[model samples]
Target: MLFLTSRLDHTDEEVFKIKQLRQLVEKCDELCVGTDDTMLTKFLHYTRWDTIKAYQAIHAYYEFKRRHPTWLARHSIEHYRPLFYGTHCRFVMPHVDRDGRVLVIFKTVDGFQRFPDYLQSLVEMDDLIFESLLLLPRVQEKGITVICDLQGTTRNFLRQFSPAFMKVVNEKNGVLPFSQRIVHIIQRGFLMHVTSTLFMPFMNKEFKERIFTHDGRHLSKLREMVGYESLPAEYGGPASNVLDTDLIFNHLLQNADYLEKLQKYEKL
Candidate 1:
């Protein structure tokens, strides 16, 4: 169970986004961020919350992960996002285990709630998010993935992604690859957007391309790919909830097609 996140929201806006993130990551059962302890202290030492919330964020993720230790199989957490207006993006992607949690955070936020108002609240108040949800024991859970997009981007790409995303933004369609930040914020919202990409490989592909094209210097984009839902809920897993799967389909949409393809590939 690989865990990834994007710190698109620079504003300290909500709590549920992070908490809801906890809920979604229940699959990991052992939350870990994308950074080392030294860096984490340096990053949050200057913040207003005095890094209390920062510590909470880490503990929250770990506690959530601890709940279902058996569910996690492959997990990575990318920290940070590429900012067009400012490189000092306040939305610290945090120190994740895999280092990719930042991007995963961004991907989750954009795909889920479409970056709704509720999501921002989570970032502002981390515990509220957990409070909002009716959580059950690890023994009782649902097969669902919940992501919160605290950052907002109203980009035109939401309407017209390439076959890798929407099928209308392909080079043949005459839609140029405009600056995604400009388009996503204008179309989605400066600090709000959400959706699911498990069943949406095109979206994930385009997202990776954006990382490679926009922030390649600071961040490294992976040439390889993996999608959730293709994994078994119980393979190499603990006897936790089916919802506590090693493979987590983030945000909103599930990757039925990706799952199907994985099966075919396995057979071949």
Candidate 2:
């Protein structure tokens, strides 16, 4: 999870805006907003440097944590660990896309029959991964791109991803600091239709607009969207870019401290 952060030199105007944002956030004692420059910069980055929008986003973020204390308190990496040993349900890619946005690849291989707590596990993983991605300035600036490979997915698996669950996820997505640039769903015909119908109701306008569906038959568009080098071998990228559980586990382990801190923040 550790990557070198480039020294970002903000313009005088940008610095002033961040200072303004910091002052505004600090004044609100109820909001557990950190005044770190880098963190504030990320807020500004995602909100397109609009100070008011960034402040609102920051407020919404802390407020969500404050309201969902019980939910956040139970967040654990252990819940998501089972996926790695067998199904490899979800993992962030080793490289960024053409726009320098982080790529998060999700697979439905083997389904989640073994894990009854899959929903909670997915929630914790989302929080952990987004928190990790926010550490990189490039990711903060460019947002994230998601590729959902539903190649081996089953009807039983789709069954678990109910509309109610998607509603909760969508609400969480709204408050998270990082942006989701797009979602590429790899499925077709009836299965794709079912999946789309299940989640579309919960998606925000921007999120819905950002989605790009692709059938398994043709991935040329996906390749063009994210660049061939950015994808894994299963999607027609280099074999070296194939999914590696060890690499993913190593990254998560390295960020163990942050996850601990995140649990603490969740309790707040």
Candidate 3:
């Protein structure tokens, strides 16, 4: 939406394809979204370089934004400061895995004490973080790997995942113009079973298959998949590696302008 010049070096054929895709986008007068080569390239990559599918994905993307105005709005730092400043539950790592995919981690601390009040804000904040991550050229190219750390999770936290919220999350994940390579769930006990029962129904077949469950003792497997460099010290990475909530928050603040511009693309 910000119309960034593509940093991704494109091959001749890819450049040609992007031009073709751009034409399709321009022709759709109703879309009203101002996208650049980089954004178009992301759609191409998301649809595996098929011009038609990329256009369709673009249409779906804008339609999604139009449908969810609340999520699309309020990406500025001031809007999120009060609600999410101290919240460290979800953030993208500053590192990438061996295959270059970005790492996104979500941990449940205690359940939200004010669930209903924070639900919309929480969804918008998560979208802000995710959208910021997607703006990175490398992240768009390589996609993302999600780490669901359910270590400190409790039944209370689990209960906060309402069906309506899960449905919106599923829809958001589906329409977002990025790939979710895999989701690694780190948990223990019967809670994982209960958690699975509660949320698995909302997931599509491909996403469900992408999830790999690991018990507390099986962190080694997680390390093997994500690599030590990509993880935090708490999860067995280097001693210096840590989850810096401030860093994530600061990054979002830095991109506030970009996020603000994105809101304009939504159909009123």
Candidate 4:
């Protein structure tokens, strides 16, 4: 099969021959390719963004595919969520912090501009989305949905009040707060599709326990899965987050057997 491994700075594909997949922990960073009398596939991605630029890295893929139609017609880029994040994905799995501030991420098509009117209608549902969806049409296939969480409860509450305050102005003299103005120009389709992210936590057990607890009260299906151990192998869970792309890619480059298969093929 054809295997493609994408990271922050570059993307490469190769043909993996199981023969090349050595049995060693250190080879993890390598992408491998192999066939069991079946189809060829390319998968695996590694990326990290500090804040806003993170969304850009995700968006780049979408734009890349859009700009190159010929490449797309023949090959389908399967946007993946790390298996530990599991297959039960949500199109708009919005999360709010314990403090009540909501994070809005924009990637596929920023600030809702690409969405249709129906979807746009939902954006104005301020109560539902404390934060915005960072959209970037160009990177939809890259399997990235940016991370944005509310700053805190006080800040989020202030944001809510600013709108009504603006309406008072619009009524008196047609002036609106900058936040309200941004909301008014909002596009419609950002939340139309149910999506989720494939994330690998960088912290160790103590760190994960602490951070995961902050938002435990507002549990999401994705969060539940992430917080729990992988389902037993016979049940279809992907063995463990250790083998899953998100954590494996995030935690270490010690082994690259997965990338070994790709090398066997000439084209990577």
Candidate 5:
């Protein structure tokens, strides 16, 4: 509760708005005092302190989860080992950035055959990461910064970027509790630009502003924005090695017990 009040200097109108949002969210779904305060605050902040919009966002968030039971259910790292073993998507840098947002890297390679299943795995990984962050009181207020490394991406890989995949991405981007600080697309190519432009209409102005595109020449700019030390070794940073599937899988497994405790606490 102190974290909630400390983050923002609320005016009389804002206080009333927060109270209204809290009541609405609680009516929509049971909220634990410890956990749901932060969750409620996120929705309100995302909607720019607009109670009605926050209510809509809260409703959409839970609705999306309910519709996708596979994404909503309890899933551990072991459950996703096979998918992780085959992909390079993982949360790198054990710490948050200067702005306190968690750094996640999705290195796209050229061997994914089933995009839908892979997309689900990505969603599951995000759920685990976000849930884990929620458990850590210090970082609960932080958002996520996704660095998409499309280095070796080929035409085949780009083919999987279909309308269905884009729909899922847009839907999740719209409703998640935490804000997306940036979806930094590095090593940008023609396909990246083309696809992003095509989907630009789907994103709000705020989200569009957060979508930064950088080429190889702009490594310094990328470093400046995200901090050099937080990046992978391949990106000219201090991280000794690039984060692969195995490293992420192990990291998730290591924190499994703590994450479970936090999740259970939220339900209480």
Candidate 6:
């Protein structure tokens, strides 16, 4: 069966790649049962469809998950909601962009604290978002666009963005099915810029290419990229400034059964 495309309409090239990836994954006993077409495609995309690279990517993914046991604990959305309450971190404007990618806005609020356990919570929260997105068909294929608002960011908060934390994020990005199209850093301050410089070296070339920095002076470029209507009022758009995190939490609740079924096919 053709995994990446519909059987009836799959092209010869698509069929060839799918078969190639499937056969390689099947050879890896641990990856055989859990891996699916969508996941195989994700690895292939990450590795530029090179069979060896794709295999390595798949293995690396499971290995990372094995190392991070907490990520596999299957915690509910509520478990991570406290980390976001009254914080600048949020998923604002529940809508897709012109390219069909989901837009997640993360604003930096005052009183940012980075406890030792905060890194794990951040990774878990990211996984929950990914799980929620997986429930929607074609959403994974389209990927995500992240808007990082750094207006109120302080040196203390920036200092907490350590290399260890970035390594976790980098590893997680590889395993996740969805791609991050762009990480738009808006309203950047001196500290935010310094943080970006420190973290950029650890990221892959593709990820670095997708990182765009912008000051608060004018958001015309961002508006054009994400579409003015899709942005919230704070970002010079018509959408509401209020971000309802519960809406996403409720989404996770409502789609629990569907997400559970999808989990059976996930690689991580």
Over 4 Å off in model 6, which ranges?
1-27, 32-56, 70-74, 86-88, 110-116, 239-242, 257-268
Q: TM-score ranking from best to worst?
A: 3, 2, 6, 5, 1, 4
Ranking by lDDT: 3, 2, 6, 5, 1, 4
Model 3: C-alpha RMSD to truth?
3.2
lDDT of 4 by residue, 186-261 (tens): 1122222111111112223432332221131233442333322332221222343222233222221222332223
Q: Which candidate gets the maximum lDDT versus the true structure?
A: 3
State the C-alpha lDDT per candidate.
0.25, 0.74, 0.76, 0.23, 0.63, 0.65
Clash totals for all models, in order? 80, 0, 0, 59, 0, 0
Cα displacement (Å) at residue 103, model 2:
1.7
Model 2, 44-155: lDDT tens digits are 8878899999988887776777766534525456556766666666677778888888888877665456767665555566567667667777777778898987766668
TM-score of each: 0.18, 0.86, 0.88, 0.17, 0.70, 0.74
Instruction: Show model 4 residue runs off by greater than 4 Å.
Output: 1-40, 43-216, 220-227, 230-252, 255-268
lDDT of 2: 0.74
Q: Candidate 1 lDDT, tens digit per residue, 57-149?
A: 445434433542322222111110111012211221112112122111222223223323322222322221111111111101111121223
* lDDT digits (tens) for residues 115-213 of candidate 6: 456645665666666666644434545667888887767766676778887787677666765544678888665776786677778888877898887
- Model 4 C-alpha lDDT versus the unseen true structure: 0.23
Clash pairs, candidate 5, are: none
Candidate 5 per-residue lDDT, tens place, 172-257, comes to 77776664467788767776666556566777787888887778556877888888767777777786746655555665676776
Ten residues in sequence with the least summed lDDT for candidate 5? 1-10
Worst 10 residues of 1 by lDDT: 134-143
Error at 19, model 6, angstroms? 8.0
lDDT of 4 at 47: 22
The deviation in Å at residue 145 for candidate 5 is 1.8
Poorest 10 consecutive residues of model 2 by lDDT? 69-78
> What's the C-alpha lDDT at position 258 in model 6?
49
